[model samples]
Target: MSGIVEVAAAVMLRANGTEFLLAQRPVGKVYAGYWEFPGGKVEPGESVRQALIRELQEELGITVTECSPWLTRQFTYPHATVRLNFWRATAWTGEIGITAPLEHSAVEWQACGTAATVAPILPANDPILKALALPTTMAITMAESEGVERQLERLEQALQQGLRLIQVRDKGWPPARRLAFAEAVTRLAQAHGALVVINDDAEIARQAGADGLHLSSGQLAACTSRPDFTWVGASCHSAEEIARAGELGLDYALLGPVLPTPSHPESSGLGWPEFGRRLNSNRLPVFALGGMKNELLTAAQNHGAHGIALMRGW
Candidate 1:
């Protein structure tokens, strides 16, 4: 077998970040006519970021001004094995299509949180498309500390403010109370077109009609199979845990204590550098958990987080 090919793929987004660019492979390329994210093979000795900057400029005529490591996926094709390093590009210079030579036959912007309008997307990119649809903020319920009624009121307010993803986490509560709370959260979230996942309780998740399940670290380690849900995620505090989550085919993982939190005051958090290092080249989207607030989203993204998962800040 030949050596694996390293490629840098860009998820170039519009200013609002609700859309990303996709290009139709030009004739004569392997997958010609099929659509894929705009990018190219990484040359020897070139870092993925460097390749991303060069590829976007060459293929789309835009100089990428901002980008971050997102996910890495490997695929084996008839022709070769490829390791695709995906980056999220949010800012750039030069107008697409008009500013530079068009390397592909065509290009179009795809809206996030929706099915692709373009046909025949490259097979390796199907999972990436799904990951892109996940919202950047995850609210973990704190009904254990706050009263159930108060938490429900806050959840409704948050939904009104455009919160689209939530985790119903009240492990301290009795099973009956937890189930009732999860049911109420699911109902409110559904009304706002949001998704609700029950923490560490598959029965409650199903019983409450939650959209998915969120596993605690202990539950994640004990699982032998992916749970049956539309979306499944886990809490991960280490690289090994994150890898396990990916191996289990989870939709996402929450990794951190990126900053010190009141809940874990005795332990110092993994600062941004360590968090970035642990997250490098991860296959699935990961949310930075613990001490995260609305304003920390950009900082978290810069350190390779898909988004931030909050308990109190949300």
Candidate 2:
């Protein structure tokens, strides 16, 4: 038989570093008796999104208002080959209690970072679980002016406020100014135990002793292997671009214009639904970009985004 088996899942998470829900399988099912992100097969003429909504209402008694599709993974076992699209769903109505375990044996919302230790995750879910564990934010520096001292102060301020991840995107500066700015940011990052990725200037990033490099989409596509660094990231707007980023051994990617923005006013945002669909990714970290702010974090997560890459958003 010729067939394509499709599936969907939800990573319903809370913002307080609290928890995400998982359900245990019952008897006589594929991957039976293992913990999993609750979801089911795509039914006749039903989209993955529709299947998720139906599954959530049936399994957890929670009505969803918004969902972000994030990770997509494919796995084959002795029993079956499945394509899974994962979404980050946000609850709208109905209290999320384990209403009935008729099909699902039990459900619980345990702390997120501790999932691996919980034991019994289905093998297909393991990679996505690890991807979710990584920190989801990246701060790229902006130099609207050549004032080195002023920029340093900005970097310092961001660092003080728990900005552990950063990128030195000082491209407009002439060579000497760029080097000075990178050096300053690197110093600040070190003092705060933060990691700074230099943008597109591999040589400068290396010379200034930065933590790693942030490749542009062009650079990412051209690379054959990852640069020798502690962290590597890229900027991308499409799925193919993100796949390439992963192929080059990059650690993560910032993808977007998911919302209408002045940065690219001529373009339209990805809208939450499409944004989530695009992310059904199992590759590198994909932080939603393009006109994102902190107010969208819950929405972004629900939509399948690891997090947001922002200028205004922290």
Candidate 3:
């Protein structure tokens, strides 16, 4: 850790909040032509948030109005090791008036979840791009309560409304019924260019052509290796479980009971403060689960959640 430099980086979003800015390193700096999230090294007395705000103001001439901790990654370069703390700046003030005063040579906004025309990106940026591509809301199925036919109708409506990530968790059904339903959901999801994850069943997920598998905490603990899927995530209730999810190289994790719910009325929820504590400095993108509504996305993001996972609200 001695030579590891701490740096703060910003994934600055435009007014639409879907595209993010990437800057080219200046002429004399390391990787001069390489593109990266705009930021600078943290000063001796600065917290990550403080450094982020300062760096963005200096580099972009914009005051960050709303930002949140996003990702933490460490990479080794020939000169030294660096731990890059990334934040997603969803709102800002002021214009990016001129480039002469900025340290970067050039900057460009690229749409998330798409290939960038910008070339020769920094080696460490591949994962960052993937993380950026992940949708901010994950919809979990509640078909058992809603009834399969009614749920399907609701799903189609949600899909048309731009709900892209889904989790099919029809545990009340028998194995055959679950598999059949999973297949139906997968087909519908694929038609709309959406991704689906089958909950708690790798085989069913695979058979249904799901994009990934979502493991229950019990399943996550019992597994020795990540299942074969394009995306794999787990339900985590504790800090240790979150760390374990990272160790398993999972794409994301859902941490929750962030608020009390009708389904689990006896259980107390981890208030936003506790939710923030559990997710502090997490390397893996995490979703706030349980008692979530669509309007709470900002609240979730402010507390370091990658997004929210909800059963009722899309």
Candidate 4:
């Protein structure tokens, strides 16, 4: 392959942030007829942000006002190796008119996290879509600290307040008890249109009909291939572990103690600066995991995290 081609892609969310636009490649271009996020090639001397702004203006006819770097994916096509830099375009000015008729044949906004309504999407974009579907806050179960009944009550309140991503990780319970709890959590989560991932137990996740699995760092290191789950994630403490999660094709990762927490009082934390440094230009979405709360959402996102994950105070 020659020098890698850098392309900037947008996950342009509507005002509600629940839907994003996808465009069809116009005829005569490579991958013509395939659907993809709207973007174009980065030119020499242009940063990814500069390319993104230019591409959106040229293709969608809108001026980007707010966008955040999310993920970077590198794929080798038969002809060339391409690196796709993805940004979440949260806000823009002007209506998106089809000004670049030569670039896109059609454009439509679709709900995030749902199965794609558009057919024959670009092969390199599958994980991008999955990442977009992840919620901004991942709520972990605190059943041990809060009694099971109290926890269930809290889960209901959290779900009602729009907590869409969850993890069930009460590992001290007996196998039968854990399975039962997983089943109950799944049922409640599904009812609220939330997703539940069981920690470190693919069998329990499967049997409980949970949406995914969350691998411990040990489990992640032991894995040779991606687990068969719709939304597999792993706990990553170091940059090496984060890279391993990406190699294993996990949909997302939880990285930190960005701050010192009661759970590990003696352990020093990554802090915001180090957390940002570690996650910069990472290929997959990562959630800031220790000592996180809803108020830190912006802080986490500012540091290149997809969102924040919390055991308490979500």
Candidate 5:
């Protein structure tokens, strides 16, 4: 078997705030009626970007202008291997309404994560979408909670065990406790070669000498400028919030409740498939959160997720 045959795909997301244009495939076709990103095969000798511009014209009658370079990934199937190259094209000419390209039947611009969303979505694309819906991991640390002294102990454990980065969240402490935990954790994570962001407290982050800050979706709208730091992340559920956070120049995000969690059994959850659909081409890097198990990491990574955030999946 020849590895992956070269092909290209376009994630033509309209910067229109709330909705992304999703197309449903027609019946009587391979992966027919499946919902998918809206570009097609690359012709021989054409560059991926060129193929994108041409495919958009053919499929949706749109002209591409500017695109962000992102590698969602390559997946193999039994029938054929697809080396899918994708880009987040922001600058475009015509609107993304379909122009009757062959093999497609219906299209709609839906909120990426609404519960009402359903699918004829292809399975390979699911992982990318799922990853897009996750938010960056923001870990909470205690100042000697449960007789744990060094706040860095857990952090160090996480990092040494392959955790690349995280935010340090601390609450219920005096100024001294807060500062001490922040300062010590900051130094500890840095010494262990990890990036540390502070949770919802920009001032404390700045004072404690952290790498950056993290905010909830509610706080995202209030941010005028990104903090002067190396990293910034946010929490989001809806596509609107995710876009808002992205527009505010957040470095990444955590978006979830993708699956029902033992922690929160009351509210409805976005099952894995629909979660992937909404998150497929999110502007900012997203880490899967809520109900993330260690076993799900491979699934999340395959779906275009940057990583996973967890409360108990250590």
Candidate 6:
């Protein structure tokens, strides 16, 4: 590897966010015929966002009206080591491949959350495809407040309504009761094709057969290796903690008290600007936590959150 080359990449999503665009590399380029997200090298004086906007206009003939930082990854190709700064482009103007001369041989929309139909995708994009499958909303169970039985009922209803990600986080419950509740949640979620993650208790997560484990901040600091779970995440409050979670290769993280919540009334929330600042150039997907509601999903995503993780609001 010589010097690191910075690249700005866009995952241009459809209006419903169920599909994203992939472009085939034009002949004569490296990895010609391989498919990848459309983007280009970042210039010295340009920010990643600026590069993204410019690249899209020049290549696809569209003006990116809305986008947000998502993930940053580095891959060492035989030719060069590229640092890919991935952004989620939600809204754009003008028709793709019409406003400007086509830069690539072809382009097509790929379905999100499923195996890609396109062949010979760039190897560096495998993890990016997986990350895009995570839902935009995560519901945290409040069994202690609602009572496990009522909570279970609510969980079933949410699942029916298409809630696919859940976190069981009642630390106050007795060990036996907590385990039972986790098991029940796992079963219910599995039935609906949803995923369940137990909070802080690896033993209980295993016993309940949950899909993953969520480490508390303390547990995150104490952990020396990634836990053996299909999906792992951590509760993070600051940039340092978020970076730590990423270093551990966790799938995602919950960051913030983006707004003041009933759970912690004394501390002021990080606010959106600060929240976005902390998440700038971060690698893993992160959900906005604390006082989050369904209506704030767009706001959260605009400020670099992959989604919102809700407790009471859900």
Q: How well does each candidate superpose onto the true structure, as a TM-score?
A: 0.98, 0.75, 0.95, 0.93, 0.56, 0.95
Residue-wise C-alpha lDDT for candidate 6, range 221-287, written one tens digit per residue: 9999999998899999899999999889899999988998997988789999999999977889999
As a TM-score, model 1 comes out at 0.98
Query: Clashing pairs in model 1?
Result: none
Q: List the residue pairs that clash in candidate 4.
A: none
Residue lDDT tens for model 3, 187-238: 9999999989999988899899999999999999998998889889999999
Over the stretch 1-314, how does candidate 5's per-residue lDDT look in tens digits? Answer: 67667666665555642355667777775677788877777788898778888887877777888664344456677777887666656567875564434445876766643432757577766644643333334454544453336546666787777564666665567666677778887887778666777777878889999987888676787788877776788888876777776677677777788777776988567766766666654656777777787788656655656567775555
In the order shown, the candidates' Cα RMSDs to the true structure are 1.0, 4.1, 1.6, 2.0, 16.2, 1.6
> Local error of candidate 5 at 112, Å?
29
In order of listing, the candidates' clash counts read 0, 12, 0, 0, 16, 0
Comparison by TM-score, 1 against 2, better one = 1
What lDDT does candidate 3 reach at residue 302?
A: 92
lDDT of each: 0.93, 0.76, 0.89, 0.89, 0.67, 0.93
Residue lDDT tens for model 2, 163-200: 77777886887888788888888888899877788999
Quick one: best TM-score, which candidate? 1
Instruction: List the candidate numbers ranked by lDDT, top first.
Output: 1, 6, 4, 3, 2, 5
By summed lDDT, which 10 consecutive residues of candidate 5 come out lowest? 130-139
Residue 102, model 3: lDDT of 71
Worst 10 residues of 4 by lDDT: 94-103
